[model samples]
Target: MRDFNRYRHKGAFCLMKYAAEDGSEVEWIWNSRDGVTPFCVSNRTGDKMLQHVDWHLDRRIFDYQPMPCERIFVDLSPDRARQRAERTIEHYWNRDDCAHIRQLFGTKEKAIEGLLAESRVGEAPDLVEFGSLEPGAYRR
Candidate 1:
C-alpha cells in the first residue's frame, strides 16, 4: 500500500447540521472553516484509519483535535455556504433562532469580534449588525 500515514487534504466549506439544546435540528453552513484531516495513523497500533480530525488552520497544530460533533456533514459549495451563513445570522438577529449560542461567544462585542476574527479578504461579511454594517446587510 502507498504510504498514507501522514497525508493531508484541502479543506472545503461545509454545513454543520446539529441538534440544539431543545433537540431541534439546526443547519449552519460554515464558511472558510478548517478542513477535515482524514486518514490518520493510530498512536497505539500504528494502523492507518480514516479517522476524521478537525484542523484549526489559524491556530497552532496543538490546537487541532477530533470534532466533538457526532452528526456534522457537508451540505453545499462555498457560495451556498456563504448564503446559508447569512441566513443563519439573520435569523439570530431577527428572531433569536439560536439565542443560547450567544452564551458561547460571551458579550455582543466579543461575538462581533469573533466574526471579524474569522473574516477573510473578499469574503462575505457577517450578517450580525456592526459598525456601519446595517441590519440585513449580508455582503461587505
Candidate 2:
C-alpha cells in the first residue's frame, strides 16, 4: 500500500475549494497559485484509472497514466515552510494599518521582517493581542 500523501507534495500546497462542471462544490486540494493555469488538476487523491487510450502499430495502447495534477505543491521542506511563513506575515503586515502597530515599525520594513524571522510558519504573535489596537475595529 502506497501512502501517497498529497498534502506533502513538492511545492506550496493548500486545500482549496473548486467548482466543478457539474455545479457541485467539491473540496480540491491544489497547489497552484491564483494567476497561473495548470496543465491538469486532479483531486487530492492523485489516482488516475483508465481515462485515455492510444493506438500503436497494429495494437491499441490504453493509457491509465497518472495525469500531472497541478504540480504546484511547493517542496514542503522546513526552509520552504519558513519562507511561506515570511510571505504570509508580510502580506498581513502590509495590509494592517492599526496606527498603534505602525509606531513599532516606523518606516522600517526590517522590523517586520525580523519579527517574522523569529516566528514559525502559521504561527505569529498577534498584534491585536499585544494591545496595539482596540477590539471590534473592523467587522466582516
Candidate 3:
C-alpha cells in the first residue's frame, strides 16, 4: 500500500506503479511515458523487475518461469479513451503549455508586443525568390 506520486517534465510525464501478489511470489508494476505505454515494467522492485528489464542479465534461479507483472485490465472504452487523449493533447497545444507542439502561445500583452516588434520591422513580404542577394529586390 505504498505510494510515491509527483509530476515530471513539468506535468508531462506521469507514471504509476502497483504491487501485486500471486500465490507465493510478489510483483511490481510501473508504467512509463505518461502511462501511454502499452506494457508495464514488472519486477519485485527489489527482486528482478529492474533486472528483467535489463537486456544484459543472464542469471537464473527459480525452476519455473513466472510472469513478473500483469497488465491491468483497462475498463475505459478504447475509442473514448483515444478521444480523451486527443482532447487532452489539443487542450495543452492550444494553451501553449506543450512545448513539443509546434504552435506557440502568447498572452494578449505579449501578442501585442510581438506584433509591435514585427511592425517595427515593416510587413514581411509574402514571397521571395530563391538565391536572391537581397529581399524585395527580386519578385516571383
Segments in model 1 whose C-alpha atoms lie over 4 Å from true places: 1-5, 9-34, 37-76, 96-140
Better TM-score candidate (1, 2): 2
Off by over 4 Å in 2: 1-24, 30-97, 121-140
Instruction: Output the lDDT of residue 91, model 1.
Output: 57
Which candidate achieves the best TM-score against the true structure? 2
For 1-140, candidate 3 gives per-residue lDDT tens digits of 31224323221122223323332433322222122322223343445332123312322221222232333212233333444445555565445455644343344344334334433121121111123223322111
What local distance difference test score does each model get? 0.35, 0.34, 0.30
lDDT of model 1 at position 29:
27
Clashes of 3: 1
Pairs with backbone N, CA or C atoms under 3 Å apart (clashes), candidate 3? 43-49
Lowest-sum lDDT 10-residue window in model 3: 120-129
lDDT of 1 by residue, 1-140 (tens): 42323334243333222223343333232322234422322222233322323333322222122233322222233444445545555557434656665777655555555554554424432222123322322211
Give the Cα-based TM-score of candidate 3 against the true structure.
0.20
lDDT of 3 at 67: 35
Please tell me which predicted candidate would have the highest lDDT against the true structure. Answer: 1
lDDT accuracy of residue 87 in candidate 1: 56
